[model samples]
Structure formats: structure tokens, C-alpha cells
Target: MDDLTGGGAPDSTGAPLLDVFMQGTTFFDMVLTGLPSQPVPGTEIHAEGMGSCPGGIANLAIAASRLGLRTGLASTFGDDVYGDFLWRTLEQEGVDLTRSQRVADWHSPVTVSLAVHRDRAMVTHAHSSPVPLAGLVSDTPITRIGFVSLDEEPEPWVSRAKAKGAKLFGDVGWDPSGRWAPEELTGLGDLHAFLPNSTEAMAYTRTEDPRAALMSLAELVPVVVVTCGGQGSIGIDSLTSEEEWVPSLPVNAVDATGAGDVFDAAFILGTLREWPLRNRMAFGNLCAALSVQQVGGSLAAPGWGDLADWLAGVRHAAAAGSRSAAVLANSYGFVADELPSHPAVSLRRAVATIARMSDA
Candidate 1:
């Protein structure tokens, strides 16, 4: 964790030092896992296990922070128990929330997630925030990166952050409206990178193939990445004319919530470290793969310690004459060079509840 912080110290400018800055809504997520099957309509079913955590933008925030990036989040929280839990949980995870506020008499957003069949279905109840995101951070702090959602128009603070030299990474959610309008991506020119799953990318680019979509998006953003779930991810760096395709790690996915956010965090970390484009994509894919093995979204994010353990396991298996493990070990050999001499052991992990408990 110490090595992963990326040395978040303010320069002579005296601005809040941060590696990643994010602004968005936060949700109190209740995740029920290990269900035998999806519930039929109007039927009651029992889950084998459950977990709770802060979700939404907090997913990316915790993901970045756990990876040792100085992370800061700006958003509104309701003056309620759920909101209080979210605030404390994020703070405990070492996320800086100085730009966040607690609104009076507002209801916190809540999401109930059902994780079954290696995927999840969510029912969310949320209202428009009392305050807009632009009102949360009037002066964007100097940071190495900023994360944004391309579901709507870019916020004013996003442009301000870009002007302040923050490289922006943008992602999009499923368009419930199904318009997938090309105009929705008009803000691509202002972003340093844009990551969209193959479906979203093809729909927006109006291309039949993922690579074609990636090429079409490359014409707009400097970096374009299209994630193809089981098949892997394809990316193009226009500045360097580098095109890379990294396959996904084979893992038993328990819940895929927030996996994309974790991937984005890992990719952002690699980009900040100036790693090779291929390594960046592979690292992101690995992180996302690890994240889906757990139930909770933010709580399930893996730290550097987790990466170290996974690498060690892969090498051990490779030494035991497992062909697949040997191949995987070779593919991720670069991770060894990036790990610290001694990774932190007391790193965070998914829990069944968000209640505050003594470290003891």
C-alpha cells in the first residue's frame, strides 16, 4: 500500500494532493449472494449470504485508494443512518471526502443487489441529489486523473479539472433510454481516455465489430478501450499507434458489480505509471477478474496485497507443472516488477455488514 500511494504530496501550488478525483452519487448497497437461482415473479427466496457497502462512485474511489492511489470523492450524502454508514465506511477505507457534504432531510440512495449465476440484478431507489455535482467542487483540485460517466453532459467541474491538467477517463452505463445517441459522446474530445464495453462501444460507434468500434472511437479520444466480457478487451492508443488485445483471466465470478470500476482504477494506475499499453490492459483485466469473485462492490476491491498473493499463487502453480498456470504466470510476469518489497497484510476485504467494528 505504501508503494502504491503514488506519493500524493502537494507541489508548491498547495492544492489538495490527490492521484484520482471523482464526483458522483453514492448508494448504500445491499448485496445478497449464493442464491440457488433467480427468484420467480412474486416469489420469496432466501440467499445464502449477504453483504453491504458504499457503491456508485464510491466503487471507483475505493478501488483507486486500495491500490495506493491518493483518492478523493465529492458527492452529497443524506442525513440518515445509511448515509452515515457510507461516510464512515469510505473514510475508513482511506478515501478523502473533504469535498463531500451531508444534506439535511434528504434520503440516501439505496440499492438491493441479487447476485446469482455469476451475474447480478439490481433494484435501486434514488432521487436527484439536492445539490448538483458542479456545486460540490467549485475549484477542482490538482490531481493526476479524474473519472467521469458519459451517460449525460459533462459537468462544468470536469472541464475545470481538465484545465487544471487532470487527465480524464470516461465510462458509460447502460442507456435505459436505448437511444445510444452519437451526440451523447460529443464530449469525447475533452477526455484523455474512454472505456466502454463492446456493446456500448458498437452501439455508439454504429460499428458491427468491437475492433471497428475501437477504431472509430480512436478517432475521437486519444485512448479508446472496448471490453468484451469473457473474450477480453481491445484497446488503441492513437498517440503511439499501439493496439493491444488482452484476454480475460478465467475466474469463477460470484458477482460482477463494480468490476468495471475496479478495471478503470487499475488502468488509470497503469497509465499514471506510464506502463506499456498492453500491460495496462492486462493489469486492468486482472483487477476486474479478481473483483468479481466477491459479493460486495466497493468492499470487494482488491489491494496490492491481493495482487501479490495472486501472483505468488500463479507462480507456485506454474512450478507444479500446470500448463494454464504457467501461461498465466508468464503473461502477468510484469506484475512482479511493480509490487513492493513487502505488501501490506491488513488490507481491506468484503464484509457481511457495514457496522463499525474494532480492528481487534
Candidate 2:
């Protein structure tokens, strides 16, 4: 395999010779931080800080690209300022947008998030895309992996990508209907991996224990991972008959808006690299832990540069006789060998507001 951070040159049509291909909605996310508490209705409150970025599936796209994956995104963008900002930001981050489109009169989706006490509350406004998913994936590119959301029935693109030999990874959103029907997971049989939080896993599998849920899902999908918030994550690889549980790292969380997405991206990277299942879980947990220490969603994703800096800090602390840092260094020792010698410069970071390229 090529270097972990290396990517193939784009084709003549500008489509990325991809490592990951994804199709989903992209939202303009405005995040408010340092709120003392959730605001009461009919009251005025002030936020201490704020950030803006492309959110929704863009979170995973940016996270994957920043990790040096040749990533392609297919989503509908509005012709408004928010859409313009998102398009430029993703392009600057090196994510290929050849499969995406911007509509003339459609308005961009918007999400306003309030970050408080290490958690967040959000309000979103969006409309159905003017273009359909079939339209976007009609000519899917060959890729190493495809990330998608699981639904009751698999989409045509899902079959197309699967037929092309792309290993599919699936995630699911909250079931607002509260039905949690078994039929909803029928697509699991077609996936290489399924990642869901503890609640969603239990709900779908009818198992109260996260491990049991993991086992149940593993029967269908080759790889199953259930994330249990602060407790960490549990995984079962039916192909290897390997079951592992990795604990979450201790970190001061600032905003958890896209931590899950970050974890998914990192895990996908590890899977593509064919790391041990335990290492993949640990790497995912570490990336998610680091992401929560910052604000914004997509921009807050940690690049190789961030990973290098973190490793340096841990080593320094370990040398100074810090037990916690020593333990952390030991747990993440695998990264020392995996990281590129020269990490990329000019990585994206969370900013208070969107600015012109010249101003940035």
C-alpha cells in the first residue's frame, strides 16, 4: 500500500481517484459556545464564543480528507452565501466536489447549535434536495470504501457501489417514529460494517446490553461497533471472530457536535490500513476525544498535524514523570510508527466566523 497520508492524483474530469465516496446533505453550521445554561423561552442570553462551518455529512468528508484520504462528496448546495462558504471550505480542505452540485434558487440548509456543559442542542431548517440521491450516484466512482446511512430498503447506489467492490460502512440516525423495526436493519446483511451508538444498537437489536447488541449486529454485518458515550466502544469482527472493547480517552471536551463523525472517519482510515481491530477502536476513540476539545464540526477535525502535536505533548509529559501521559503514550504507541514523517501544513481549524481566503 502507498503511504497512509498519500492520495492518487485526480482524473482528467477532476473527480478524485477516491479512497472514500459519500453522498449526503451538507448543512451550514453556526455553533455558539460558552453558554452558561440552556436559555429559557422569552429570555435574552449572550454567548461567549461562536464558530461556523460546513456540517452534516461534511463533517465525515472533511475528517476523512484531513486524515489524507482521497475523499469525494456528493451533496446539493444552495447558490446562496452559506452554500458558497461551504463549497470553498471543503475545496480548500482538498475534498473533491466533482460529484456535487449547487442549485440556482434552492436555499442552503442551516443549523444553529448551542454548546453547553460539553454537550449541545441544535435547531435546523432544511428542505428536500432538489436533486435525488440516484441522480448523484448514477455514475459512482470506484473507491476503497463507501460510507452511508442505513435505511429500511437499500438505495440503488448502495447496490451499485457494492457491486463495484467498495466495502460499505453504515450508520443510522435516530428513529423519530420510535418503531425501531427489525426490517429497518435488513440492509445490514449487505454492509461490511455497521456503527451505531449504544442506544441505537440496543433499540434495533432489542438487547439492553451494548455487547449483546454488538454480537447481534455482528451476525449480519462482518464488523459491528457500538459506541457507549464515556464508557467507550465495543466491536465484533465476525470475519476474524475477534471481539474487543476499547475505553474512551480522558479529555476536556468543549463541543461534541461532530465527535461521532470524527470517530467514524478515523475508524474507516484504520480499516483501510488493515490495522488490528483493537487498534482501530483505540484510534477512533482517540480521534473523537481530541475533536471534542474544540468548537465547530468539520473544521474541528484533527489532521495529521494535530495528531503529531498530541503525540509530542504526550511524550513530553511522560518524560516528565506524568503517569496519565505515560499510560496514554503506551496505549497510542502504534501511531508513532504510522504517522507520516512530515505532517501536512495549513490544516483546517475551527474559526469564529467564515472569512474570505485572503483574510484567512
Candidate 3:
């Protein structure tokens, strides 16, 4: 097992088992916001907001870590400047990358996201050497759960991880081939949960209705969640044969880059905490909604501090006992109590709120 203290720094050796072990790619994302208009051949337009951070799997890992989940990320990083920055950023977010590989002389993956009023256009460039999923799975520590994508086969490692008592959660990307065949989920029966967007689920299951897609997918996995942007999310817990829906929170979006990934991270955290299916969906939706209000993918992901502040603000606003307040308090009862605070966390929340207001 790799050392938990990445740099050999002294810390608690009795720390809990990794809550969510993940295998995927990480990127250094450059965020350019307030682009007055899309770029033209020779037009030069400066952005009002600029920021950079680690993205992709880093979004999921850092989001989970910020939500108080102990996370481990397994992937290859380059030995370049972007790599250094990304590595440091993930470390600062408290993600364990001890099992991650670093390639010499390789440039880290990078993405330039141009934010244009609640939407974005991203251009990404990755090294020719693809992320070795097989190697990452082999390097994962025995954790409560593991996360991966279905872009590759989950063969021996996924099954092996399950046999060792780790729950496997999976996600999928859009298929340009339009094959979207159900057979693509051949060996995924071992997955504890499968979270796919509405379009992906409908396409894969060949069902026009999201509910039908959820029910059909529940037969293949223990848990199936279909995220419907704006409309909300629908999920079914096969073990209990219970189905639930959670509406998306109302929020002004600035950039919707990694909202889905942040939702996945929040779901993983809720699952680890043994929250009810409804609570999990609502929490996940809240986290994703909060993410889009910020700029960069990873930077936009809300931490526990953000969650606390949001809940506090919601509670304080709901003090008048309005119907909406009553409903929100009842739904988020799990987080209604007081929470610990720190100076850094407060500062982060203050800055994020100011940015969102300015963006509006």
C-alpha cells in the first residue's frame, strides 16, 4: 500500500479507509469568463475573470474530499509545469494520489474553457499516451467504494475489486457512434451503482421515457440514477425496489462545465455516509447546482464549508417559516445543525458569493 502521507509528512496513521477510490484522467483547466462574444478569426476579446485548476477526475476527487470524503485518485500525470500545479492543487484539496504515476517529459492534459453566459465551449489537448485504466485499478487501495467510467472494459479489476468488498460505481459518456446498445453493459452487473445522464440512459436503453430507462437499468445494476439537466434526477434502488426523484435547486449558472462530475462526487459522499436515496439525490443536485455558479470546474465544486454556508443561509432565510423554507428544511434535515468553521473556509465562501453576484 502506498503511504497516505504523500510527501512523508507526519499525519494521522489511524485515518479512515479511503472513502472513494477513483481511476480516471486529470487536467489543468484554464477558465476564461465574461467573454463578451465568441471568438472570431481575428477578434481579440479579453475575459473579465481568469482562473486555473486541476480538472476531470480531479473535479470528482476534490469535490468528494471537500465534502469530507477520504478520496484516492489513481492516474498518470506529466512532469511538466501544469502537472506540478495540478498535483499541488489536488494535494491541497486533500486527495490521495500516492498510487498515481508521473511520466517524465510529458505535458499534462490542458483545457481552455470559454464561459459565455451560463454555457461554455471547451477545447482540450491530452498527451498521446492514454490514461492506463488497468494500471490504475491495480494500484487502488482497499476502499469502501471505487469509481470509474464505462468508456473501457471493467473486466478483471472491477470484479476483483468487488470480490475484495469494495462497491463499484460507474458512469458513462456520450457515444458518438450512436451504438448505444444495452449489450455494452455486459459485465457491469458487478457495479453497485450506475449514474448516467438522461440522454445517455435513454439512448443506451432505447427507451424514450427516463423512468423506463431507470427501471430497465435497475435490472442490470443495484442502483441506477439518471440525471436530467434542469428537470432534475430520477433514481431507483433495486435492493429495496424504491424509486425517487429530486428536483434541481434554483440557481444562476455561470459555467456548467463539470456539474455532472460534481454531482457524482456528491452522490458518492452521500452513499458513503449511508444517506437515504432521496437525501443523496437532493444533496447531489444541490452540489451540482452550486458548482455552476462559479467558473472553473474544480474551483466551482463546493466543499463542506460551502455546503454549511448554503444550508445556513437557507435556514436563516427560511426562518419566517414560509412554505418553501419549511420544505427545504424538511428535505435537508440531515444538515440542519450547526457545523464547525474555519477562517479559510469562510474566506472561500465569501469570495465565491462575490464572484457569483458579479457574474450575475
Candidate 4:
């Protein structure tokens, strides 16, 4: 009965069914080095090389591919080094990029991350908007898509997706204060979930109590999840359903970049698998948990088995004691003691050689 698909996947009783499609957005990431200490005033810190990866769609596509989905990435990038890498990465990950485009004269957006104390701060510049607003919808294989996710965009496609029988989720990474209000976003779109962490929620709601803040969004959508570091997350699913708290897994954070995006991918994966709502939050939490254990954004995400092992008490526990930093510190100390003398120096040498080869 739908324009997208004949009856658009109706059941024997002529009701709708959920058949999802996974797609990725494109972003560029630059990884830099810095010690996790307060920078001395006016002092230039020693530096490291830039490591680039495909983010947003590319990043999520990698995860989806690993999960055995027929994933696709729909975005535009330039015919530069980053674009080449993006294409290769998607193909290697088994995602369909036939519909993905490379435009002339446009530069893929770039984000630079400064790593400090196992965390990072980023500065981003979109050389140009890679995908225009008009290019959001596609006719190819639209009927199979059970859900559509948009990050930071809440317009025309939101209503279109709803019409196509796709569940929708929107992520607000960050925004300039008052760039848009919470109600404005909530009103602008019909969403199943609105994913914004505590910091963003506080800014959007101007409320410190995360529960109250998450509840505020539920007035519009059926669910709202607000992620916090140690405090975990607050979620609400129904009008009469109680708000729930989802805890983060313990990790030895190498860099905090892309944790939220990984959470987005995991949430999608969980939802597709028909996971219980609490487990969906748990899966998202676990995905971020795996991401922070290593360096950079897309580079750090764990395969599903790795995440499952960690949660099953089969791995990572020895490294993430009491889910505490002390555990990570202790684990690092033990590993260091077993290594050859000057382990960090040797590790750096090995890495530098590889970087030079890759850049060559």
C-alpha cells in the first residue's frame, strides 16, 4: 500500500513488518598526540602524525559489516586521499558503496583530535557539505529499510522515513548554545529515540538532573537515552513505563573519540536483533566501552564477539578492574613489567616505521 514498496512488507494479516536497512554517513578523522597533562602556558607541545579514518557512515558501516549485514553507505566525498581510503575501507568491510558518490571540487570534512589523559578534544571543518539536503532519499531498495537514522539532521527525510514505515532515531552530537532548542528538535521530527549524552542534554534542557531532562524528551518520542560517563545513562520507553538507568562498562580509555557514534551503531545493531530495550542500552554502553579502550575513533571499536566476551566475563575484566581506572593502570603496569626493556620506546619505533610506510 506504500509508494516505496507494494504493501511495504505486510504480514499475513496485512499489517506492517520490520525489515531494516543499515547505512553509514561519511566523516574524516585526524588523530594527533599529546600527553594527558595540563599544557604549560604558551608552550607548544610535542606532536605526532595524523591518522585518518572514515567516520559517521563509514564508521557505522564497518561495525555493521562485521555483524554480517548487507550494509550501504550513502554520502559524498572528494576525489582526494581520504576519499580513496573511504572507498577502500567500505569495500573491504563488505558494504555497498555503488550508490556512494565522489564529487568534484569538494573536500571531505575533516576533524582533528587532540589526545590528552586518555581523552580527546576535536576541532572540525566541513570543507563543504558533502551530501546536500536534497539527496537524502533514495528509491533503490527502499522497501527493505526498517529503520532510518539521521545524525544532527531533522527535516524532510524524518517525515519521509516515517511514511516509509521506518523507525527513526536522531543523534545530536553537539551544537552551539541555542543553535536549536530541545523542543525545536523534538517538534521538528517524529523519532523513536533521541540520543544525546548528559552534556548535550544539560545544554538542551538547561537541567542538571538527567532524569528530568530525559523525561522532557519523552513527551515527544517514545524513548530518550542520555549517556553519562560514570553516572551511566537515563532512559524512558513508554508513557507508563518507568525511566531506566543503563551503566557503562569499565574500560582503560586510550582515547574518547567516537564513543558516541559507536554507541549509535550498537544501538542500531541491538534494535535490529530484536533485543530487549534494556539490553539495547546495555549493548550501546558496551560498544562505547570497547571503543574507549584503544586510540582514535573508528579505530577503537570492537567486533561483536569482543564485546560479547567482555560482557560475559570472558575478557577485559582483568584489564578493567572494578570497572575502575585503577584496574587499567594496574593492568598496564603488569604488562609493562613483562615486556623487554624500554617497551614504550620500542613500541614507538615500530609504530613510526609503519606510519612512514602507510604515508609513503
TM-score of each: 0.94, 0.95, 0.85, 0.74
Once superposed on the true structure, which residue ranges of model 4 sit more than 4 Å away at CA? 1-25, 37-42, 47-50, 130-133, 136-157, 177-180, 187-189, 239-242, 308-360
The per-residue C-alpha lDDT of model 1 at residue 130 equals 81
Clash counts for all predictions: 0, 0, 0, 5
**RMSD for each of the candidates:** 2.2, 1.8, 5.6, 9.2
Candidate 1: tens digits of C-alpha lDDT, residues 1-360 = 224555466645454588889888999999999998889999998998888889999999999988888998998999998898889889888898878999988999999999988778899999998887778887767787888888865777788878889999999888878889888898898899999999999998899999999989998999998999888899999888899999999999988889888989999999988888999999999999998988788988898889999999999999999999999999999998888675575656656765655522
Superposed model 1: Cα runs more than 4 Å off: 1-7, 10-15, 356-360
Model 4, 1-360: lDDT tens digits are 112112245444333332334444577776665554545788867654445666655665665545444554557777876677666656755566545678777777777777777666777787655567347434433423323443344445446656866676666655656454655464424667778878777777778777777877677677688888766677887743756787666567766777786777667665655555676677677678777766656656666455434434532555455455454344223222222232121001102111323542
Candidate ranking (TM-score, best to worst): 2, 1, 3, 4
lDDT of 3 by residue, 1-360 (tens): 122222223224333367678877788888888888789887788888777777888888887777767787877789987777777668767888776778887888888889897777888898654546566554326677888788766645556667779999998876769888777776567689999999898988899999998989888889989999888899998776678999988888877878888999888877766777987898889899999888778778887677777887778778966678667877887864323343326312112221322422
lDDT of 2: 0.87
- Estimate candidate 3's RMSD in Å: 5.6
* Candidate 2 per-residue lDDT over residues 1-360, each given as its tens digit: 455455676665556578888888899999999999999999989998889999999999999998888898989999998899999999988888888899889999999999998888998999987887558766757788988888634557667878989999999877879998878888888889999999999998999899888888887899998998789999998888889999998898888988889999999999998988999999999889888888898888998878988999999999999999999999999998878777458666767777876535
| TM-score top scorer | 2
Candidate 2 has which clashing residue pairs, if any? none
Please rank every candidate by lDDT, starting with the best. Answer: 1, 2, 3, 4
